[model samples]
Target: MPRNRPLAAVLTTVVLATLTAAVTTAVTTAPVAAGTAGPKTVIANLFEWNWPSVGAECGASLGPRGYGYVQVSPPQEHVRGQEWWVAYQPVSYRIESRKGTRAQFQSMVIACHAAGVKVIVDAVVNHMANTDKSGPGWAGSAWTHYDYPGTYQVQDFHHCGRNGNDDIVNYNDRYEVQNCELANLADLDTGAAYVRDRLAGYLNDLLSLGVDGFRMDASKHMPAADIAALRSRLSRPVYIVQEVIYGAGEPIGPLEYTGNGDVHEFRYGKDLARVFRDERLAYLNNFGEGWGYIPSNVANVFVDNHDTQRDVPGTLTYRDNGIYALANAFMLAWPYGSPTVMSSYEFTDRNQGPPSDSAGRTNNSTCYSGGWRCEHRWPVIANMVGFRNAVAGTGVVNWYDNGWQHIAFGRGSAGYISINDEDFAVTGRSYRTNMPAGRYCDVIHGEKSGSGCTGPVVTVDSGGWFRADIAAHDAVAIHAGARIS
Candidate 1:
């Protein structure tokens, strides 16, 4: 059900005429370090990527580009199928699936750690596969609806009698939402001690394999207290980000899960898309909590994750083209929650799986070909990872906007970026910052080459100002880490 849940929150678009206005604000906090020795929270979600491909990416692109963590899809054995949703249908806790075998999974983790990147596995512990029929799992484990051999049986599941079936219908009912089956899948009785121990045993098995964290799949169906209880059973303290999607008036909201760990701020992406599509860019000045989101510190934000890209309309995805890159740029440059850059495969069919062989083993992604659209490797998005790390703890300063589709801001003296979404090109503009006078490579369009830049190089004078022209729906970013010596 993780792949099929519907969004309960309704986002409204506000249209208004462009206005002219200027705003400035300055805030400072203790600097946080990123890179090898410090905390690097930026995540690259390589959805549906096979183990080998994920490991290769860590060495070739993710590590060198400064991405600290790579969030991979679930690794457990799942129901035999080619659809991506099949990955969410847990047949067993064994680390075997279309992705790879247990040994391959361990090797991938080792490779990632070697490249200074941690691995975060997607954990689907809410329920098992839909029990419409009985079948053999990908790893040859036989399962039928609510039963799996050597695993849980009928007594371990919740059989809430409702809607002529156990399927969840009324989301407003807390008991039904938590206890009833979702999408005909067998729901686990998480509150039961035996079931909790079984789930924790599965997670501890993963911890033994060197996983750094987990993205708890379908956390909404499992109560926040249940998840906290599950965490207490972990072998060691690992980073946990729960997928408690926010619904407008739902009794079970994201705030209830903060004590557990970081919760996905579903509002950030939907509201961001609304502003970019129908509203003005100036509205982003007071983004984050000011816009009614969770506390920034524990808020995990993304433009469009795997679920949102397909299910939640209006949220920016890889399909938005240049606008998508600009949105990612804005997300990385601005001081907000820890952001995740989505890497997706091109698909016309929503349920279609990634490129795979006849036996359903995922093929290696060549990027920009063979149906793999590696957005994480795009020049603008990849280089911006470095920008985010460089400006980690700085606060927004010298904020400037044209009150419509143009805006610029500085991350203290660490970095600065100007984005223009207007139809016409914005030219002959000088942006002032507190960064020391130096030559910096516009990371959005180029890279640092030797003592110079491979593309446009902007020079800041003694006054900490640089003049540049930005094309429609484009961005220019410069940071201290990419300064040309």
Candidate 2:
């Protein structure tokens, strides 16, 4: 049941204005602290895997790897395997999905938190379960298009005639996107009083469970004003990221959700993929505004997402090669939107589930075992995670470039990095790093016997400059805290 419309609407407005104003005031008044840098680079996309698996995987992989957060798949109750999109067809605000039981979900959340990694659940509140579908969900809830007897029923859905077409043809038309069905999924009347109460209850539940934020799916498919309304009713400072995939000239782009939260900068991944893989390395220095990108702080950058990995063609070509290393390395090194590194399991067919048994129980793919390849476990990618963590809050100072295929930059005085992707060896280039005089460890290619680092000491003199050679097809990162500097 929905809540009172007029009152809910008024409350929502007040919340949005207060939260937005508070954040704005903080940004304006707070001076930059010495070590309190800008954003950090540690984000992970949790595919549609179960809770136990997520906990086990994050504990074993991401937790130890020092990822700042893990963006888990939708946790709402949904139709079970009517199609993969069934998850998009949310049935109710229950923590029971294909992932795991409520207890398991809570355990995963606790485990991730204990490991110093935050959890961001993929929220699908824009609409509800698709109409006319009948199936039992992970929570044993049965749903139908027009009727949900004794379970969950929303009578205010748009009439059948209104959503006759499949694609949303009008970008400027806000109502059609917000009130219309997405991919034939049921549309909820968010303005309804009962609906607002239920949705807010669900969000509050997640917050109580120690979840950090949300990655709103198909955000463009909803009305920005309504989203703003929904966000306001929640507690202050909930990290919200919207998925609005747009290219250069798309009329309805991410700007619509500017004040709401960070919008997914799909263009960054596409452009970075091309430049890092096929083009010369010199093209990297002229990043950020040179490539016509949104400011780094307001964007959520990724190399590939679930939709693009499965649907978009030509976006991801080198999922198994050195190009992946170079592309991800550049994303971590460069100042961009909050970066999210994808951790995928190898699959011959796009729709195939994670490594599973004959009875359909999902299981982990071993690193040494030849069944699946977990890209996050790769040495190059994992090492870069450490580099990004070490250089947190530093500006890109002392950028050096030997034309294309050779580039270098330092992050505030904390860390310095250089890369060479050319076919031949590149050397004899140096830059000012601004660190104290002493030797520091190069995170990449250095020895890591214990939990910390050792080897490849970089000596930054009193002049704040150092000389280093960049090997072909490889990258190097040096930090201040590891070695005496």
Model 1: pairs clashing at backbone N, Cα or C within 3 Å: none
Residue 319 lDDT (model 2):
43
Per residue, candidate 1 scores C-alpha lDDT tens digits across 318-356 of 766666777888999888899999999888878889899
- Backbone clash count, each prediction separately: 0, 10
Best by lDDT: 1
Instruction: Put down candidate 2 lDDT per residue, 239-297, tens digits, no spaces.
Output: 89998877445556788887899889888777766666567667777676567766677
Candidate 2, lDDT over the whole model: 0.66
lDDT of each: 0.83, 0.66
- Model 2 TM-score? 0.82
In candidate 2 the C-alpha lDDT for residue 335 amounts to: 66
